[model samples]
Target: MAIPKYHELRISALRLLSDGRSMKLRDFLEPLANEFKLTDEEINEMYPSGNGHIFYDRISWALSYLNMAGLLDKPARGIYKISKKGVTMFNSETPEYINEFVDKEVAKRDKIKKNKNPEIKIIDLNDRQTPQEGLYTSFNNIRNSIYEEILTTILTKTPAAFEKLVVMLLQKMGYGGEIKNSGVVTKQSNDGGIDGIIKEDILGFGRINIQAKRYRLDIAVGREEIQRFVGALAVAQSNKGVFITTSYFSKGAIEYVENLFGNTTVVLIDGKNLASYIYDYGLGMQVEQTIEIKKMDTDFWDSMANQ
Candidate 1:
């Protein structure tokens, strides 16, 4: 069965912490998951955004809402305990009443925020997004948030780290011919803008030059940069080049690569595409869950009826 809605998750979380013990979020998740009798497959299911497991994500959101309502206390990051109010609610009423309590609390907070800023809007946090379209929109929003975090984390790493990440990704995509000597980062001179070299085959009959740019997400890679990389490829007498950046390329830059009708081939990869590759190849990310959706087989049913 599917996990409960957001408010229900809040109720479950509070009941689990009613003993007044400060529980780590990681530890609390186990019992909460067990209470629902969720299979390992169900627990591992991921959201469409591929950022996190759906079960864990919903549980985290429930904890956030409960904290906002003053029913839960966070003594430290990822560690939560039930508040006096939460204990009272647990003892006096059914978990369903927590929904009403949370609604009032959220409304009060939104009203306070609205007084300070008229532009702010308060939305109904429960049961409004039940349809498929609403579900997709919500999933996309979560995915976008995750993408922002990935870019921010990438910015904090060294340029060499980014280079190594790209190499690892290409190798996973089957670009590096063999395990040993598949690719090497040219540290000695920037090699006229080339950061690394990848061999196409084990025999080294062909090679590809790689230029990695750790540009800020807001910045755009221009045609001039691509041209310089092309010149570097020429200097090295290589016909293949890959120009990758943690930012997007301008229209002119893309057109330049498309119109360059010669032996040289330059493939451009931007920030969004880069992150997608990282996710797909599991380079820096891990599998949180795998979910499978089953559809009815009309042909099999029809055959049974005919029989």
Candidate 2:
């Protein structure tokens, strides 16, 4: 497997817990390694695929959700047990279909809450928000902005520099992209689209090849461009190519890339991806300043209200 999709990891965690052992996250993770045939370090290195760790967070939320909804139960903190509800679910399912089950439970919870609450749940828009909500919004916005900056930065740099920037950006997002923004990579003379490669796990080493392109948003990459990149991969006898572009791929371009070959494979990354990489890595963000500040002073507030 190139990378185990994070939802798979969540389901794996639950299946491990269902073993009737009181397990910590550490314990739960071991079976995942055995199942995936990976080491502990590999599990630690696998980052979430989308929305940063929110996908993993969603998985964690799903676990709690299953427990709360009575599909699973907790015997203790850090220990989860499959309830009768869970057993019924397990017997009727296959591993590939677990996500559907989690989604079902999530829906079930929403329906139950609606029946009991009846009134609209109080949700304040961020314009008038709770401290927790405000913090989440602020951080997420900062992360989004950083991704845009990275794409734009690449657009402005030389193609030679784009490869290094992409690696640095990946490292910033927390992927193990070992890149010195300036070295001649493995097939430096002959390889076409490939910049330096990034391997999240040694398992992914031969399975992945990454190509970087820097362009203005208006420039649309077409299928021929993708085909050329794929040909470069073939020269290296590689299985996959990731074409990362700062501009969008034409719809025809996307369809053409996917259908380009039966055994050959390529993944297209356009402007949207360029931004996501930045956000995923927390790229271009540094702590500029911080201050210890007082929260609302009760007396000051009271005086203002009286006046």
- Candidate lDDT scores, in order, read 0.80, 0.63
- Residue pairs clashing in model 1 are 44-289
Off by over 4 Å in 2: 1-131, 168-190, 198-207, 282-307
> In candidate 1, what are the lDDT values of residues 95-180, reduced to their tens digit?
66788888789778768756844744344446476565465555554554466557767887899998887777787778875657
Q: Tell me each candidate's TM-score.
A: 0.59, 0.43
Residue 304 alpha-carbon offset, candidate 1, angstroms = 2.2
Instruction: Pick the TM-score winner.
Output: 1
At residue 293, what lDDT does model 1 achieve?
45
lDDT of 2 at 203: 55
Q: Tens digits of per-residue lDDT for model 2 on 136-186?
A: 665654554455556655666777677776666655655554533322233
Clashing pairs in 2: 172-281, 173-281
